[model samples]
Target: MSPAAAPRVSVRLPGHRQMALGLARQRLAIGILVFIAFTGLLGFRLIELSLFDGPVQRARPAVANPNIRAEIVDRNGVTLASSFEAYALAARPRDIMGNKEALIAALIRILPERPPEAIRSAIYHDGKFRYITRRILPEQAEAIRRLGEPGLTLEREAERLYPHVGLAAHLVGYTGIDGRGEGGIERAFEQRLTDPAQLEKPLALALDVRVQQALESELKAQMDLQQASGAAGVVMDVHSGEVLALASLPAFDSNRPGGLVGMPSHMNRATLGVYELGSTFKAFTIAMAMDTGVLPRMDERFPTTPIAVGRQRISDSHPKGYPLTVPETLIYSSNVATAKMAERMGRQRQEAFLRQLGMMDRAPGELLETGRPLTPAPNNWGLASVLTIGFGHGIAVTPLHLATAYSALVNGGIYRPATFLKVPEGAERPGRRVFQESTSHALNGMLRLAVLDGTGRQADADGYRVGGKTGTAEKVLEHGRGYDKRRNITTFAGAFPMDNPRYVVIAMVDDPTVGSRMAGSVAGPVFKKVVNRIAPVLGVAPDTSGASEPDIRMFEGLYKPRDPKRDPNAMRRAAAGLPPLEGGVR
Candidate 1:
């Protein structure tokens, strides 16, 4: 049959139908390509968001409030405390999807410090969210994120960082995980530190890091050598009341403050601990007497014979058998002589002098931890109180208070408030005159003599001409009910370059057991070391004019030789002109 017309069966064909079918096939192919492209783009976008997005994008709604604190720097612009962005691990207990026991066990492996029971309890708690750990490292955050638990989350937060670790820890305190300042200057200046408008500017402290290091090193060495429980030291600009360096040993690292909570190591001994600073107060007593004209002249003599007040007897630790001149009283650190002077000054005048020296109140400073001085009540200011306080036994004051007083003694009698903030050059601080310039000069000369020929002889730092008084006081026990004879607080408070005083340095050792346990043996060496190291850094030139010689000779023949073979009673016998007793004096 013919191909095109077999049995006359021909298919009908229309041009419009053929065109419509071709158009429909094309439209369907184009629709499928568009859908594939849209799906590919969506997948890429999701990958980018998961891998490249910042914590801000990935953080869950349970994040804590962000706290940004201002930076804290030393006088030289070295950063001490600063803030950085960190990731914290948080958990939404209700949202946990993994096996509870297994998840907690795994968490314990990562955070071994957390007990297994703690993890379990936290996960089982009814709270919506809670922090597992804060300030997690990036690797830790990554490990936590890969745990595949819906409850676990990484939250962006700000964390305070102390780059210097334990350096000046007592002064530049740490903050809580929530970024609130907890102590030290951190807490003292919290408002200014957190102010939004002031955040950009760093808080500059008067602390010279070099000086601080020197002070800490010496104090820590003495603490270790003497097996002391604690120690404190300070270096202050006498003229301006700027605290160049303040150190308290057994200090905790500001970075890990939680470890030190409730620990004795956390105490700011320089400011918070009030102590019965022994003979160091003798300088102040003499200065006060001289200033008030109770002692007419340095040549005026006070009986060195033991004085009886009730059952207590006031005697010099290392007494000169003869009477002591006003300057000789300080040079020999004669408690009996000083008590007689206080008796002459009387209670009212003595209290008024102490008040003038700022010893009757808490130390004026930015630190909220400034200790309230333990002064006697008005009614308790009897003759016995006066005698004991004259020799620094009844009254207690912080090392900071002593430092302020010493500054006034050397800085031409100006009593300025101690400050942690740097004082700009030419800045004028409001201060009150506590001593006459003549009185200050005379006291300085006598202090220089004490270091030159007396108990503070060990504290002389070559040409620095270190001048200070040694104090060894028995610690009070049972909340001031009695005294612990074995335990003592040894301190040496002084200033450098006797010719012209620039810095007031203090070193205190709490309960030293090694060697003699005298201020000269424990704290005086620390003062010398600190001054030796920081004097050069402070640009203080050594003056060897030997101007303290005359002052030193004024106390000639006043100090009796200590009999080492009979050390326990040497001081007493020397005072009494009796033969040495067993155990001699220290």
Candidate 2:
């Protein structure tokens, strides 16, 4: 082993060769280290880019059509409102390549409705973007696109379409250009309508389009005939408080929201206008009296003579010239008798009854246009107030309030809050009991009798057994300083098929002319027309059979027919309290 070690160091080499070999070894070692370092740096840079680099540049989103909003339908699946795709004309001020004046003139030619000044302003504005016109027709959009203006653009948008024009305008409402609800049911259900999860489903309302048409037709005809300032009507299901038809005259087209500016055409008179609904209150008064046992029997007599209270005299519009039974008071619409009955009930009980019937508060429903009922202050609710309110003078309420109260009166004494939505089967809330079932039955009989033989004769629909009350209240003028002798608000509060009432129909005319001022002459006829047409549509079969035996037996001998042959002088003498006939008043 020692000998072999000594032999290895004997060789000599040139300086350049040795230096080259040394350099090569050193370079090889350095190259291997550099490779490892470069590999690690590249791996670190890749990880950094993957985890911590700013957001990577992404391609612009593709332009797509706007999504359509949901549709609105009536109870029978009739489409009321819907949406469709449309193009909006917009401009990019920076990208506009055409002459500004030329673009403005071209836009005016295609969309002539736009003012020339507005189009010019939009085209020359400093802003980056502006919409020249929204909801343009497809043809108009195509024409503008073909103009080849770099600045002009057609962006897809959703537009609301009202199929029925003015039908249910107040109920279905209208949406703005930005695809948001502006009023009525559309506004009430805005969240649900625009919800992404429910856009495909249509909203169903409780209104029956057929019934609505009938009601509007009759109300419009009567309004035209009477030359009224305005008219309103409603048809409601009593048990569920579902509003079948609600109409306000002077209706505006929902599709044309711009035309409604500075106009009262969109006022929902049925639920938003409060008026003194005259003798209709008599029915409520009599019902309250019966329910509370103040008037024990239908034959109980109340003197019809004018009652002087606090310098104000309450008298019947048509005097009976003698004491009238509880039933006869309503039949004759005697304000004096109704006042007497209401006075006996007193203000506390009277207010309680009204409050129970939802007359003292805003109408409960989905609509935001409900009016708060006007009532006297607690301190002002004196004896005179009670007497006046008995005939619907001191207290003012919307036609909707009257309709709901009438529903409670005949719908087995239940007072349910009115609803505009379709109530599923067995989904109705249990209503509060405002009167005894027996009281409702008795009132039904009296209402029928009034239509058959009393002042409500004009409201009688042949074979349909329509029953209701007529109201004619003088409008308060000069802000309640006094009443206007020339103006009156006439109303008819009615229910059909008197045996078992299913619907409550209310028709009212504001400030009808003198010739048609009476409710019996104006609103009564409207009610009859509406009921006659909607009865079969609502599935209410006509019962040609006369009043039931119990009804006849109870009402027999209660109403004394006017003797057409009686001496006119004798009748006059009796009215003056100077009696000549044996049956005359003392």
Candidate 3:
């Protein structure tokens, strides 16, 4: 072999020190490279979190960490329910370097809405934290808890829990999956509900559970019996103007609202249903005439002669041709007489009366949705228009409008707006005056007569001395070009304890079919049924005078000379030629 190629092998080398030097150099280089790569990665992560985070992080501990559920309470300091800190499953796709598949399977058990495919993609995406399930039930949460730590994270967050699921469903609206109020008092008082500093206080509502239940029960029975489309009932304290019971059927269970039908159950029809209010406005008109010193006696007659408006006919449900007295006008609900009164009062006086009674405006309350009454301008008002309005026509008002007006008429002519929340002591908002004291007192007696002997007999309770008006206006249908009078709205607005009025009850049914009993038949009876249930709960004992009421008549046939020769058939023929019909009259 050549000398250059000869082996450099040394015998008995000391500790192989020269070989160790080469190996150490290689190891040092690897260590430097690893440290530099780690620093770059950490810097990138800091930038990503700081710059790209939105409400998620502020909501993160809320969305991730399970330590911040808020508490919910009722007015009486009852813990209807509360939430506790619980882990919500979320994932940072990039951070999940392990099995993306197995992690998703674990996640599926917690949130079914997100299928395995969705989870896999989420775990593989570049998001910081994608929510898997928030506000999970305790059982579901426990199941997720059993999943050992891997790609799964149990970050602390507040989970909403409703203790009494159906008790206050309407009052305490539920929160979104992320713990935010969506409706009812929860949404209304959201600032208060989610207020970090003021959660110690419970949300106080003016609802009495007992009264609400009673009202609901009666309304439900009627809804089913009548097989009606829908029903709403309200009981308001005439004196305090506090809403005792506001029940709208078809209510949804707020605790579980996933599959709920929107718009129907959630709608507060009592405050939202604006209708012509039929003859319910008659009481207000009569009161206005009485207060204005126009109708001096119940026996004073209005020329029961049918009058014709521009395109509408003024008549009564029950036709009378004689000069009917004021009491008879109300007892028989003479649309012609009412129209005459409206004409005498004129549009200016009518508007003034309505404004004074708070009917020309929206119903009073803290509800986000309050209905406004529709009163066309007076200049546009004509004789027929004024007459129709006096008898409660051409002008559409809400049930609340009727309620407020009735309350004023009974509460010594003081108009008070209705409220859903508790009003403080000495906080009685003495509303503007709509009726005079004597006028109200006299009307109360006349109203009692109507209940005892007139069209309002159905609303009379055995002892409550309930006096109210029945209104049934053909439902104004908007066809292709004009309104079709195919449907109708039937309503009854009444007050109890004729001697001392305390509460005003308003019951209304929309588009009630022409059954064996019509609006006066169906709606009036339904209203009486509601009164039956609510009167006791409201502590308004029966007067034991249901069988008897004060003696008062609408007219004495003394206001105007009665013409015996006035052929009723001629007036009918004249009214039949009642201005060419412009809108649907069916």
Tell me, what's the RMSD of every candidate?
A: 11.1, 10.8, 10.4
lDDT of predicted model 1? 0.82
Over the stretch 358-437, how does candidate 1's per-residue lDDT look in tens digits? Answer: 88888778988788989778877899998889889999998999998999999889999789999988998889998998
TM-score for candidate 3, please give it. Answer: 0.77
For 1-586, candidate 2 gives per-residue lDDT tens digits of 6876766565656597889999999999999999999999999999875653422223432222123567899988899998888888877787888788887888899998888887888798787677787888899988998999988878787889898899878878887655677788888887777766778899989999999999998998888888888899999998999999999888988888876755778788888889999999999999888877788887778898888998898888889799988878887889998999999899999999999999999977889888998899998999999999988898889888888899999988999988898898788777899999888988887887677667888998877777889999999896877789899999999998777789999999888874858899889989999999999999987644442211433554566645422222333344456645456321
Q: Highest TM-score among the candidates is held by which one?
A: 2
User: Candidate 3 lDDT, tens digit per residue, 439-534?
Assistant: 887777666656655677677677666777778777666652234465666677788877678888887766654463345676778778777877
What lDDT would each prediction earn against the true structure? 0.82, 0.83, 0.67
Instruction: In angstroms, give how far residue 52 of model 3 lies from its true place.
Output: 6.0
- Residue 530 shift from truth in candidate 2, angstroms: 0.6
Q: Candidate 3's error at 290, in angstroms?
A: 1.5
Prediction 1 TM-score vs. true? 0.81
Candidates ranked, most accurate by TM-score first:
2, 1, 3
What's the true lDDT of residue 345 in model 1? 86
